[model samples]
Target: MSEPTPLQTLFDTLPQSGSVEWIGIRPARGEAMKALNNVMISRGTGLEGDRFKGRETSKRQVTLIQKEHLYVIAACLHREAISPDVFRRNIVVSGLNLLALKGKTFRIGGVVLEYTGLCHPCSKMETTLGPGGYNATRGHGGITARVVEGGELALGDNVQACS
Candidate 1:
């Protein structure tokens, strides 16, 4: 029998780009909040809110990931403000599964990041992108993370995931 791979080591060890693409952030329902150096507030939910075990509160926090998860290549063509259906993450990442980044710790430009949980889609997506927004691709929009060690993050930043 082979030993299972550690959850912390899910992604390949290759130094890849698009692991941390910083897309433009806009207001979805309220006034545009200032992007703080260590705190950029974002919102998300789980599939049917099940990820939260039926909690009604929408998950909102700062998002983060490893350098390999940025997905800059994709962001350049699609742009950060593109339709919500696509992985239009305010910060499009690559290596790590944004949905599965929960509870993990990573680093971005020397700042420590703490993975929270999956960022499931919500009604706004359906309303904005139509029923197609409810498709499998849009099921869980992505995941959310908090900047434990806040710092200045910009496009093309090299993020590092630490266990």
Candidate 2:
């Protein structure tokens, strides 16, 4: 049998580590609750097109399968983390070592989300940040997570990770 994928491994290790803090969580443009509700009701699905394939063809269309995927939290550098395009994450966290969390799961505001895979840096992020953004953090800033247990999340809530 073939070995399990990285995501599989991650799932196997559950309630790994979790944390939460008060941070700004906003919906991206056209990602308002109403919009998401419309899509969910109209399409009966939250995911949209192919995230990687449509990158070249349709910039407007979300290329990733997990469209409307919420960024529970995002971290950015106040000054040192600057780039031409803003690496604006929905939730900004500090004191948590994301690298260490690799192959582990973390909970935010009581809502558990598995770190399925690395949020790879994309050209769009480079374009938005311009030259400075390309080399910033050596492409370390990418935010992607899968919902393990769905629930209402708000800013300023305590985030914890279960061992």
Candidate 3:
């Protein structure tokens, strides 16, 4: 076979295995999401209790951000570190680059999730992160995912490539 592309090589190696540092599920729009130690997920239910649950048309079944990216975003705005909740992502992992999982499948605890695309920053980030919050979080917005398998995801779960 021909040599793999740089990204394909990284995908094959995946030297970075990380843990799920935080989890959040929003029950409804315009409301604060619930931070939890564990949450159930499935292809049909997405993240249990999440407002986006059962929305077949939606590809944004879950959202993830890297814990280290929080600092990067803060520095971009000349502000202190922000919490995962401020970004409204479902999971915050440390170590692995969320972008690396694009077009790949990964497991968080027992759940299988496929990276769909980048989780771009929304206008709410401006209000939540302050004047420059939205812009600061632009590239650090993290990744979006869709559940492919049903299982329980807990805090400190080992997240790694499926194969």
Candidate 4:
């Protein structure tokens, strides 16, 4: 293999580690999310009880968002605050720029996940966050990932991208 370019080196560098601040799962479609301190991640599936179940190669086995983005979205929508559960993502993390994990594999506790794509806002955001909801979530919708390895993950677990 050839030497990596400067941009590749920069992209591979991630010294900051994030912490899982919250976890949630929906038992069924359109149902409210149930928050949990911890949960089991299943390979080729997703958060054990999450309503979504995609194929083994599915890019959206799990969804994660930045905790800080929640506040930003709220501010964008002119709200004092917005609960993480309302976003319907599987995990809310803080301190790490999730975008850095794009096209990389990362670990949360013992679970390993591969970044798949961006988790764009769906029309549901309109009904959930009121007017301008979808627009407010644009670019702040976080990223989607597929499980590479299954294990238990809990609130406070460290999230780090693999080298």
Candidate 5:
């Protein structure tokens, strides 16, 4: 095999580490998210209790958002603050640029995950976050991921790129 190009090397090197700030699971579609300190991540099934029932190869087994983006979205909507649950993502991570994880596999505590695609804001944002909510979350919607290895993940668990 040939050596990796400069860009590949750059993408592979992620020195910054992040931590899980919050975890949420929805028992069913359109239901309110239930926050938790920790939960079991299962291969093929995603979060143990999440409404998601995708196959093992499904790209959107789990959804995540950056904690910092919440502030940006709030500011865009002229709000004092925004809660993570309103985004309907499964995880809220901080201290890392989640975009950097695109096409990469990372670990959350003992669980490993591979980035799949961007988690775009849905129409529900308009009603849940008020007017202009959809536009406010346009680029801040974060990414979707599929489980690579299953294990326990908890609030405050270290999140880092896989070597």
Candidate 6:
């Protein structure tokens, strides 16, 4: 309806492309995350067997974190390494900037997802990351998305702007 501002233009441009590095599924609330190379996504079900599958029907259907941010998050906690699992997000991607996808759709494998907003750290991080877990993940938590197209997504799958 109107011209987008420079910031909006940049946000709409997905300059970098990356692949799905890893996948995680939370089978139950407060349960340990399970790592997987592949996962099934349905319109209503977030992840086939994930605990949050049908509980949420909004942009929170799926979550993703940039793999590169893991190091930054770890540094904040003064840790040698931080497993992606600790974040509890559903997908780990590298190269592409998730923030840039807000309000836009991207395809991961055959599944399409629309970015909602930042997946800010929850109180769970306090215990998950240990002493400074919560604070370390403050800005590095990632983003949330609602499934747009249901399909299978797997490790090494290319994620790019919707064509």
Backbone clashes counted, model 1: 20
C-alpha lDDT of residue 145 in model 1: 63
In model 4, pairs of residues that clash are none
- Candidate 5 C-alpha error for residue 12, in Å: 2.2
Off by over 4 Å in 1: 1-18, 27-59, 64-88, 137-140
Off by over 4 Å in 6: 1-4
Q: Candidate 3: lDDT over CA atoms?
A: 0.87
Going through the candidates in the order shown, the clash numbers are 20, 15, 0, 0, 0, 0
Candidate 5 residue-wise lDDT, 1-163, digit = tens: 9999999999888999999999999999778999999999998899989998889999999899999999999999989899999999999999999999988999999899999999999999999998899999999999999999999999999999897
Task: Put down candidate 2 lDDT per residue, 44-82, tens digits, no spaces.
Answer: 111221122222222122111111111221223234324
Q: Model 4, poorest ten-residue lDDT window?
A: 47-56
Model 4: CA > 4 A from native: none
Please write out the lDDT profile of model 6 over residues 21-128, one tens digit for every residue.
989999888898999989999876788888984544676899999998999988887877888998899999999888777778999999998878999998888877
Q: Candidate 3, residue 92: CA error in Å?
A: 0.6
Q: Write the per-residue lDDT of candidate 3 for residues 1-163, one digit (tens) a residue.
A: 8989997786677767899999999989989878999999978668988888656446789899999999999889886877778888999999898887877899999999988899899998989878988889989999988888879999999989878
Using Cα atoms with residue i matched to residue i, what is each candidate's TM-score against the true structure?
0.55, 0.49, 0.92, 0.97, 0.96, 0.92
Model 3 ranges off by over 4 Å: 1-7, 54-57
* TM-score of predicted structure 4: 0.97
lDDT of 5: 0.95
Evaluate all candidate structures by whole-model CA lDDT and list the values in order: 0.44, 0.38, 0.87, 0.94, 0.95, 0.87
Query: Scored by Cα lDDT, where does model 4 land?
Result: 0.94
> Candidate 4 vs. truth: CA RMSD?
0.8
**Model 1 Cα lDDT, one tens digit per residue, 134-161:** 4433434566765455455555556555
Candidate 6 TM-score to native:
0.92
Top candidate (TM-score): 4
Candidate 4: tens digits of C-alpha lDDT, residues 23-142: 999999878899999999998889998888878899999999999999999999888999999899999999999999988999999899999999999999999899999999999999
